[model samples]
Target chain A: MHEYSLVEALIGRVEAEARRRQALAVHGLSIRVGELAGVDPELLRTAYETFRAGTVCERAELRLTTRAAAWVCPSCDAPIERGAPLRCPACEVPARLVEGSDALILDAIDLEVP
Target chain B: MCTTCGCGDTELVPVELHEKILAGNDRTARHNREHFLEAGVLAVNLMGSPGAGKTAVLEATARAAASKGWRLGAVSADLATDHDAVRLERAGIPSRAITTGQACHLDAELVHRALHDLPWRQTDVFFIENVGNLVCPAIYDLGQAANVVVLSVTEGEDKPLKYPVMFKAAELVLISKADLVPHLDVDVAAIEDALARVMPRPERIVVSARTGEGLDRWVAWLERRRLELGLVGRIAGLAGHVHPPGARGDRPAG
Candidate 1:
């Protein structure tokens, strides 16, 4: 899965951060995945587990949070819920996606420092 | 000695680093985009499933564009072979093949490397035909001006619904193999309906590369896109700007 490649990128970033902070090891990582980001959280965790060996995140706990896709009404600026009609509830006009489509963020990291 | 933790002399710190996981790739993609824009090259990322005629469509397009005196270049990615690149070269276009050892999708970094290998200045329109899988490629940004997803009629009409991410990410969708429609049980209308349901007002084109059925229309669309990207003047000296086929405005057939 593409999750493996993403995990690899995540590890690279974690390693760089850890090195910059003079941290000995990473204990945990918190990530936010958006629903429309096209990533599987379970697969990402599995990939992390498989690839973290001998790295800074060897024993790091991978915590993933998901964000739902959001759409905004162009006519009235109302937030439209996912799976709802594309039309805005307030203005009865087609809605536009404003945010929540991407969430590949590493919110925080727990590390063991000197 | 740490006051907060009982463990002897070991400090456990929680660092607040709000960084994106794919930031590296995104940064590279942005760089690639800048490179293309600076060169005035219209880079298009062509994506489709294996056997979806991605290469065939590119080959046909290259041939037609060459005939019109427009210089085209291509980069094809696959697990192990250079066959697609060879085919494009045979069609008289400068092409390179990025042999991804085990990568499923072509990332921006790989594409950036491939872009350097090509004589991009001489090329007006550049196409990056990504690996055949539809799932992984949807998430990757190849720094292309447009993402064109091709689906053959032989594939099920529900493919768009089945792979919503790919369909949703597509800037344009091409339903290939229109010539085979008379022989197959495929319903092109159903495919269009499925795409419309998943995609937000998708611009779809139906073409048959084998019989040159919609090649003119496809080229015309490419020419229009080139003009929109402000690349017409750059290539005008080489190609003299042929009139775009009138069929370019033909809507996706129901």
Candidate 2:
């Protein structure tokens, strides 16, 4: 899956940032995954464990936060429930998805510096 | 104790990055979009399951576009062979193939590299036939003006509902192999109903690549899309655009 590739990118980013701060080691990593992002959190965790053996994140705690999918009605500005029809309940128009999908943000990282 | 500086205690700091995991790929996709726009080419990303006749549709579209004096180019992706690219070239279009050894989907970086290998300047309509995968391809954007998903009559009508992510991301859906409808138990209406349930007002075209059944309508839709993307002078002298066949009714291939 593409999770491995994303993990590798995460490693690279974390390493670059750690080096910039003259950090000795990494302690933890916080990541946010959206429901509609098409990424499985379990798979991502497995990838992180497998690929973090020799990287700066070798001993870092991986904290993953998954967000739910939400849709906002374009016509009536109402929040539609997840798994509901894409149409707005108020105005009966197609709602726009404001958030809860397509997010893969690396929220924060803990680094051990001298 | 700090191992690096012989300090009494280690100082831990929290860094806020707040960056996307696929930021690199998205940046490259954005650049590719600018490049395509600058070249005045209409790039269409064609995606679907394997054996869904993605290549066949490309071939038919290539031939039809050629007769109208329009230039078309394609970049096909597969895990192992260059067969699809060869087939497109045989159809008289400038084509190239990207062989992604272990990867299941085509990313923007690979397509960017493939763009350099083709004569994109002379191309009016460019097509990227992604690796025949319905799942992974929907997650990656190849900087195309449109994402078209192909589904054949042989596949069950519940495909759209089963693979909602792919169907939802697609701008257009092509129900290929319409010629085999009468010989099979597939229900076209059921497929349309499924698509409607998953997607909001999805645009669809039913075609049979074997007999050139809906080539005119398909080409007319493509022409309109290209013109909308500001490819005015490039497609000006091409064959007059045919009006898109009206209504959602399916026509049995003759």
Candidate 3:
């Protein structure tokens, strides 16, 4: 999986935050992956499992959620359903993804602070 | 019952981060963009398949840019060889080679380091010729104002349909090796239609480095896009674009 590098980046970001906050240990973490981010959750989870050991996230549980790409027609305000093609079923123009999708985000970190 | 089994955790505080996993890379890429602007350079992230003729296109581009007086710099990446850099330099473009080793794509760190190796003062347009893979390269932002994908006729027309994410990431698609169109049974229109289905519908220009087809169009696109991206104005003001206050994720150091 291309996930190995992504896992490396993910772990580093968490480690940086853990160090900055003076956390004793990381207990848990939650992340949001967009559908268009090209990351499979299971693959990411497995990748994370391999890389997390021995890091600040060694004992931390990962919670992953997917953010659906909210596709809207160029002219329409309403969103098309999930899995819709890149077209407005109604307007037939082009579809655009609203903000907040296509990103892999760390939602929260459960850390043990001194 | 809240365990799910962290099971009666003693003292774990929930810290809200909402940070993007790519935020670190994004931050560095933003810095690279500002640095490019400092030298009046416009950057392009060029990505494509392994044999999609990216080096050939750059060679052709160098030849085309000469008459127009466009100064081009390249940071070329491959898994093992510096052959592309050699080829580009032979073509008269100032080029640096980055051997990515096991990495399938070029990240901001490599680009940042490679930037120093380029002749910044001589470069008005810089190209980060990404490790030639259609997938991983699209996900990376190398501080480029334009993302161009090169797809050759040999690769087939339906590649964009099969690889949506990479195609979707492109701002421009170069249909390379157009000289082979008459011999091959591929339908260029089908390729264009597939791209239209991709979100943001990237603009495409068909070109052949061998026959010099559409190279002028490609060069003109670069010239037009450089202006569109406001390189001149950014370079005019000594202290133009600063890193956005929140562009960096919230670490105390940030």
Candidate 4:
């Protein structure tokens, strides 16, 4: 799965950051993913564990912030709930998807500089 | 071995490596995109569930391109066998099969390799027919000019709602197997309604590959795109310069 590859990148970025900060141990890593990002959290977590086995982040925790697929109708101005092909409910217009979904951001990391 | 400060032991020291897992592929994908731009070739990545009639649509479309004299080639991704490639080759277009072993989708690296291995210097348009899966392929980039997501009426109308990412990412949507509209219980309107919600308004084409239904519009659409991409001009420049003699010949080379 592509999650494995994504996890590898995350690990590499964190490792680099850790090295720059002179951190001896990383406590955790945080990522924000949206509902519509089309990624499976379970699979990603599984891949993360396997990938972290020999890395410094082996003992670090992963924090994920999930956002929902919410939208505001460009025509009706009504807030659309998270649904397949998100649409506006009130005016029957194609709603403009706002921001809870389709996110793949590496927000921050927690580490102890020794 | 561990007698002296345990230094002789295979120390399992864990190095903290925090990273996004998709970073590697994303880097490759970006490289692949740049490559397509440099080559001046448009790549269209096709994705959909199995039985969505991807092959049939590709076959009909390639056949229609014959009279137009457009240089078209295809790389069909599957887990095994070159059946789809053979089918496309029979239509007088150069095509190849990409077996992904047990992988579910076509990744950028595979496509990058395929481009180098194919007769890229001759062809103007290339299509990467991804393995028949909706979930995995959407996440991988194939250095495509456009991404097409094909849906059939036989599948549930809630498909778009169920798989929002695929619908949203697609530049075009083609509803296949439309000839069975009368027999099936599909709510075409509902599907469109769902698509409107999740994605920007995408060009929607309804066609039945079996009966040659709605081929003119589809072909015209392709022609319009070809014109937009300057396909004729690009191929003309390469006709005598790059294309292999056999490929440039009037007869089908393969």
Calculate DockQ per candidate and list them: 0.55, 0.56, 0.43, 0.22
lDDT of 3 by residue, B120-189 (tens): 5557788889998887888878888889999998898888877877888988999999999999999999
**Cα DockQ of the candidate 4 complex:** 0.22
Error of 1 at B16 (Å): 2.7
lDDT of 2: 0.84
Query: What are the per-residue Cα lDDT tens digits for candidate 2 across B159-226?
Result: 98878778888888999999999999999998988886556656799998999888888899888987
Quote the RMSD, in angstroms, for model 2. 8.4
Per-prediction TM-score to the true structure, in the order listed: 0.87, 0.88, 0.87, 0.80
Of the candidates numbered 1 and 3, which has the greater lDDT value? 1
Evaluate residue A31 in candidate 1 and report its C-alpha lDDT on the 0 to 100 scale.
91
| Tens digit per residue, CA lDDT, model 1, B44-151 | 999999999999998788766666777788999999999999998998878999999889899999998887777865777889999999899998887899999999
Which one wins by TM-score: 1 or 2?
Answer: 2
| Per-candidate local distance difference test | 0.83, 0.84, 0.82, 0.75
lDDT per residue, candidate 2, A8-112, as tens digits?
889999999999999999999999998777788999999999999989999999999998767777777788775455777668777676665768899999999
lDDT (Cα, 0-100) at B129 in candidate 1: 92
Of all true interface contacts, what fraction is found in model 4?
Answer: 0.29
Candidate 1: residue pairs that collide: none
User: Would you list the rank order by lDDT, best first?
Assistant: 2, 1, 3, 4
